[model samples]
Target: MSSPSAAESFPAHTSAASQIFTTVLSQGPLTRSEVARRAGLSAAAVTKAVRPLIEAGYLVEDVDEDARPALGRPANLVRVDGGRALFIGVKVTGDKIIGVLTDLCCRILVARYVPLAARDPKAVLGSAAELVRELLIEADGLGVRVAGLGMAVSGDVDRAEGVVRYSPFLEWRDVPLAELAAMTTGLPVTVDNDVRALTVAEQWFGAGVGLSGFALVTVGAGIGCGLVVHGKVVAGAHGVAGEIGHVAVDPAGPRCHCGNRGCVEAIASDDAIVRQVRAATGVQVADAVEAAGLAHDGVAGAREVYARAGDAIGRGIATVANLLGPERVVISGEGLAAYDLFADHIRDAFATAAFGSAARCDVQTRPLPFDEWARGAAATAIQSFIRSDANQHLRGAALTQPA
Candidate 1:
């Protein structure tokens, strides 16, 4: 595939330039003064940074006659030219790989899903490369080049290194995914924890937008939490943070895959719920779906199992609220299929456990389809592309070198 046009680069090399572009991208069609105010930059800085971007066709300016001053000078609104570049994002799950093609603004243009025949790194990478190839073809049809690719997987991922440090579902360890995918797809690649990547998308364009602090807790195959603190995603020093799944809620609870007992995940994860339901009901409940079905049927043991799982989840979320004191918590994930069964328990337990003002944090649920996860991956790619300094820092010798 051909590289993106020079105009597509957006001249986003400096921090000021990137910041100006981001301000416009997120809160666009704004006058220079508004951009300066939002970005915390001077008017001169905004002008200097926006000039090249506007000249490169990445930003378009519109004159606003209605907002004209008494001096008769029209206010010009600056906004991102969404057609300037294209990108591909992929979210790999245990069952399928969801892919999306997006514009510079991270708007989804096309989406596709491919079943995973295997869980090994090699197989998943091949599947991902093929998906990228298909998306690139779509980009070709759109007469644009794909500037970058982002892959999101659930686990302890080293985004800076683009490695899957440990993915329990895929049974992968220390896989240099970004380098391999970059070699195959010939595009700059970024790999991030699935939930964190999703949180980035949420923070910029979804639920967490304009919020200084928030938490996204996903309950499904695993209990995942993505935390945004001070308007930034919290990536711990070791590339792992907001791992609420492993927060032990009960010392004597079931064992978690992470070798911890009584973890929220151990009690509320899909597999955990299924395991407990089976044991409690003395029935062969194959999966979460079946367990939910039994619970909905008003089976005594199955209902109690879901309620217990909900309690664990609520406690986990309360822990997050107590510690972070975020303004809101958005609960999502596939497990929402059984939400009816445990919704009350989640709210009740949370209300009981949350401390003081933390209990006032807005708790809501939004069901995001798998395609949204793919869009989150695209958001990460856009982030890396815009933040050149961070991208370069991530590409250091330690990360690029083979072990």
Candidate 2:
């Protein structure tokens, strides 16, 4: 497993300090008063916490030229200095690996893609290591050291233990990804479930900002989810808090690779859709794109397949809303490319299945570039660098923020 960089420690002295820094990092360029208000801390506490961060160059302050009053000295705005340190985030998919070089603020500075011809552990790790080295050279050119590497993989991942318990798409099990990556790159590494990594980014800067309870549902190769309850991302007892993809929606539906029938992923995943489309139309479709092509062409069987997938996805989302009562649900991922085909069916199923006020939960669809998931992986690396132990024992603790 990996921890913070060996030679440096975050400037903060306590978890509260880390949280304060996080507040400034996410919603900054504000007066200290605003920082205190959002973080629910006193002004004195905010100042004390921010001092070291500013001194260390992790945070900076500037005159709010427009907000300056004519009668008094201008107030300064506090914000994270993006160039203080560098990080690398990588997202591993079935066919390729997406990597991004990011600054301390989790903003992407450079991105690279590597095709993976093999899914074995050794092959995938080799490709990722090469990509990391390429980004490291980019970091060297910028005169900054990459403090950490974060790998986001789709599967049941135990971040605290830094293990990939199981990844169906990669056909991996019990892979010590963090230790291996750290060895290969000579940098502290953080390995996390892809969707949860994305959630961390969403919670801090994307759609889930300021919401105490929300769910992020991703539709694509797999229908995954990430949940935030009581102001903390839920990893659950088994690092599977939001396995909405595995939730059974139809008792008599198709069998899933996990040996379960009617799981949401079985009916709505890219592979599942292609399989169903081929079966329904009695034609051999090549992939999800080809399957969706039939549907958009007004083929009755193809449209029915998409309708079924949408219904399943909606039911899975409703299960989260009904169970957690989140204030909002954000739908994202690559599958959004075909959202128009099944958008109505998903909403209809959710409306019919939701119980009580859960039906009122606001659901929004946000289209993000494919590289966004890699950026989320970098967010997790930023978290690991700032708070070395925040993810340890996550199954039983509540960490309100990533840092």
Candidate 3:
């Protein structure tokens, strides 16, 4: 990994240039005029921004033959050069670490997974480092230098500080993950909340693209949300925005690890569902999968547990829609594997709880694999690379490989 001082600089790294580049990256291969229109910038600014990017090989232009006019010259379309740089992204879970090697366009070229022997910060970081090393080796084979590494963890992460202020699933608190990762992986690092990192990818390339406002709600070992407003990802004042999981829906419901009763996560998270299903059916289900199997087999009590979980999730979605009025809400996560059992309950509860025009918000579901979450971590690295406003403290390099 190169130090910030040694790393190549982004050409004309101004906000306008960043915005223009992002426009082409997401809604790409457009004429300069189209870039200007979409970015709400003047034509001259778009031209100016495109020049340095193209010169730096970060962007390329091609003739748009399909848009040829009767009298005028054919328009030239500008788009990102996906091969300009490579990045590594890692997602840490309780049992495993998922890693991906991606290009500047955030396309995954290689993916690797390593199961964790233990969940302690040291063990997870070691597993993460091993996974990242494998990806780095893949990038070496591709003859591309990985520019950065992004780490996504589930918790109340302080991105600006590169710290996991609290991660209940991993039982981590105030861990300086970015700095530690940089040292171990020997790459510049950016750490963030896993859900928020996923939101970055969704906003740029997935379901949230082209939308001014949207929300990503993830259901799994925990419930989490990532919110975007006014075309910007909202990282709250305390680096804790869009925490729909903690929103209490039932005062008498199960207790959450966060010390709250009836929080959405307490009812809908994977572990929560397993606990609830076991209690309802009086069968000690080993995991969410087993609990779901019981429900799928027409076990009434087990099914009710799923229904309640769905209702909690739906209420959480309604709260987001009503409060922020996002244009769309995307439901995803590993828990979507059992979507058939609870999909209806989620929709029904959302329809009932959402008020007035808020109900107009489009709700959809998308399936995401663990590797996709790792790709989201890569997106965070891409964001940091292009934007000066991204978390600065998280961007640093290590002089040596992991011990």
Candidate 4:
């Protein structure tokens, strides 16, 4: 198989240039004055940074007659050119890999899914590489070069190092995923924690847009939280900033996989709910789907089990609100399938637990399919492309190493 050459390099690699571009990318179609004000740069700096991008075709300016100044010159709206480049994003789960092809603006152009044959790092890389190849072919049909690839995995991922420190779902540890994937797919790669990847997408285009502080709580196989504080994703120094699942809610509750008792995940995760439902109903429930089915059927004790799970989830979210005091919390994840079963309980518990001002925080549900998670991965790729320090070292190192 033949590998395509690298696309044209970004015209400007300076911090000012990247910041100017990102401001337009996220809140685009704005006047130069608006871009300058939002980016905290002088009008001269915005003009200087935008010149290279406009010349490189990364940004386009259009005259807006309606917004024209009454006296002198017409103001032009600047925006990112989504068709300038293409990217591939992959979300790796326990049983499958979800991939999407996206434009520079992180819009999904095509998406594909493939079941995983194994959980080992090598197998995951192989499957992901195959998927990237398929997407590259699709990009070929569009006569566009696939500029970058982003992979999102659940667990402790070191994005700066391009390594998967540990992923319980994949049973992987210390896997240098970004370097390996770049070699296999012959494209620049960016790897991030799955929830944070989704948060990036949310920050750029979803419900969290324009908000400086927000939380995205994912309920399903695991209870996860992604936080945006002061307009930045908080990847703690150890790369484990938002582990809301491990928040111990009860000292006498069930044992969590993390070895803590009564952790939120122990009570509210999909496996946790299934385990509890099976024990409460004395019937063999294979998974969360079946447990939710039994609950929907009004089986004895099933609703109570979900009620408890909802309580735990609510408490967990309340903890987040009290600590961060975010403006909003967006609830999402695959487990939202049973949202109706526990929505009331969650809302009630949060209301009871949240402190005075924190209770005012807006809490809403948003169902995001796995394909959207893959698109979030694409958002991370777009982030890397526009930031000078994001995964640039890994890409540089990958280029020197043999495939």
Candidate 5:
């Protein structure tokens, strides 16, 4: 078990309370009646849920001066107190570690980045810890306690177990990341899949807000997807839901690090693009950046490689649409930098592959930088802090003695 630096407890313990709080966190300065209407709960229940949170300083209620009537008192508006506490979120990529300090509202206050010299667990952890310490110093200057730390890694992450089951990008397997990070940082740690963490952020404050079903597809070092079904992020029986990158689109295209052939990731991921570019153009490129540069400079083979990758990505996305039919699919990640090279191919292939109304599932692009990914990690920590199931395991809650 890990120990937290500060002992802070969220007062709302029931599902209704969490739902109410989440409503306010995402859509507030809402009035109690508005919260009740949005949350589908009685006004009394909203009041009950808001009281404890307000008393604990997690929420603040203020008079809506602008809404004051000529003959009656103004309605009180309820909102989360973003500065009540702090959290640290770290995103571990193959070559770098990004960390951010965020408040209860998951707003980033400070951000730091460190290059990783190696992908070994120890090396990555060491770099992450240094970046975390820098953020901790920033938090200390703000005089806020960082209640928790969240780490997001690519691949099969078992958030419930706080383990990295398998990360092909990092070449890690069965790593107890939470326990180790907790020991080093002396704060409660939550480990989650990178895309899922980003989805949590999306659900609360980004494109997926108020949407019952949506998908966040990332293209960069890896092709990843996170699904929200029935307003909840889906974690399959083994916490490996929405592995769109592994969707096999071709049998003889290329080999994926996951030991699969012609998967979407094999052709669309950054490394994959670099590999294919080198083969097609017979030019050795140092990284995806150089490969993209070559394509931007009108290199024939390089552009063709990107188009082919786009086709694979489009097919993989169509597979998602055909299977689940989400309301929207938001395409994002570092790869969007090269979107111009393949956007047409992606749209054309998606149009050809999508069936019936599935093609109308609103596809759009958004760019989320590394700092935003770090903020996503913070959002996971915030989700863990407020959700009921997570409350039981929070270090402070675990040590509290019932009155």
Candidate 6:
């Protein structure tokens, strides 16, 4: 991707402006006073921050019909103009790359998927560039410039540096994905950990919205947790936080790919479940879907394997709750396809392991399809665009107004 042009820069600058814009973007169509109140900025500050945004066409103010004044000016509501610009996001999994074209507000306009022929960094980047080219064509049809691109991959990604430090699944290390993708496609790029990127989408528009603290735990090929504390996603000092999957629940448990024994992922990840089920049932359960089916059909040992996986997962969650005290935990992922087989066990284990008020944390499930993950990648791009200080190459271009 090529770099974003000077004219396509995102203009929402300053902490107050970003805060106000985020409040309105996430909970929008609110009056300036409401924006100030919600964002905890003075009304004057809200007005000051909103003017440039409105002038730049990034924000729009509409007169409220319900609360119109007969004599005075109508109450104008400020909101993000979703059609003003466009962004592209890509979520890379071991098997496929899911891409989404989104508006300024992170609403999905078009979604596409392509199978990955290989996991090598070069191959992945080639496929990603191709996918982005396709989305850019879609953006052209809508007559909007693609302002930025976000790529989300699993593992230890340093979003600040736009580097995939190490991805066990992809066997990648120190890949400068952002810079490479920028070269391939002509847009400023933001690369982030897949789960954290997803957490950004959740924080702004999904289950984590309006919550001061919450956790999203994904169960599938891997067990991943995204934590929101005090309304900010905790990236940890090392860019690896809320790694409940690596939390050792049983000292004598199975070995994990991370070189740990009895970690949550060792017992609960898709591969772990498959391995355990095959050993316990003496049946060739080829994959998670088959294992789930076997358990659903009252295969005795197969059900036990799911129960064990659930126990490990619940313990991992309890560890998160004990430490963070989040108000809720949203359980999701492809693994939820077999949720019925292990819901009771997860609940039981969590209840037993949780300490005091931590047990009160609401645990609910929501299935976030791959498209949402792709949308999450878009959200990160939007985030980086708004917070231009982080990416230096994008920063220079971000100073200009969008045309």
RMSD, one per candidate, in order: 3.3, 4.7, 2.2, 2.0, 3.4, 2.7
Query: Each model's C-alpha lDDT?
Result: 0.87, 0.87, 0.88, 0.89, 0.88, 0.87
- Which stretches of model 2 miss by more than 4 angstroms? 1-6, 65-74, 392-403
Residue 222 C-alpha lDDT in model 6:
94
Q: In lDDT terms, how accurate is model 6?
A: 0.87
Best candidate, lDDT: 4
Clashes of each: 0, 0, 0, 0, 0, 9
TM-score per model over all chains: 0.94, 0.93, 0.95, 0.96, 0.93, 0.95
Tens digit per residue, CA lDDT, model 3, 304-376: 9989988999999999999999999999999999999999999999999999999999999999999889999
List of clashing residue pairs for candidate 1: none
Residues 1-403, model 6: lDDT tens digits: 2323454656766877888888988888899888888788898999899999999999988866787778766778888899998989999999999999999889999999999999999999999988988888788778787878989999999887788999999999999888788777767788888888899999999888878899999999999999999978888887888888999999999989999799999999999999988998889988999988889899879999988999999999999999999999999889999999899999999999999999999999999999999999999988878877644344222432122
* Span of 10 residues, lowest total lDDT, candidate 4: 394-403
Q: Kindly provide the TM-score of model 2 when superposed on the true structure, using C-alpha atoms.
A: 0.93
Clashing pairs in 4: none
TM-score of 1: 0.94
Q: After aligning candidate 5 to the native by TM-score, how far in Å is the CA of 202 from where it should be?
A: 1.3
Output the worst ten-in-a-row residue range by lDDT, candidate 5.
394-403
Question: What clash pairs does model 3 have?
Answer: none
**Residue range 1-403, candidate 1, lDDT tens digits:** 4444331343777888887888788777789999998888999999899998888888998877887888856788888899888878999999899999999899999999999999998899899988888888888888876777889999999988888899999899999988888777667789999999999899887898778899999989999999999878998987899999998989999888888789999999999999899998898989999999999888879999988898999999999999999999999999999998999999999999999999999999999999999999999988888885656223322221111
Model 5: number of clashes? 0
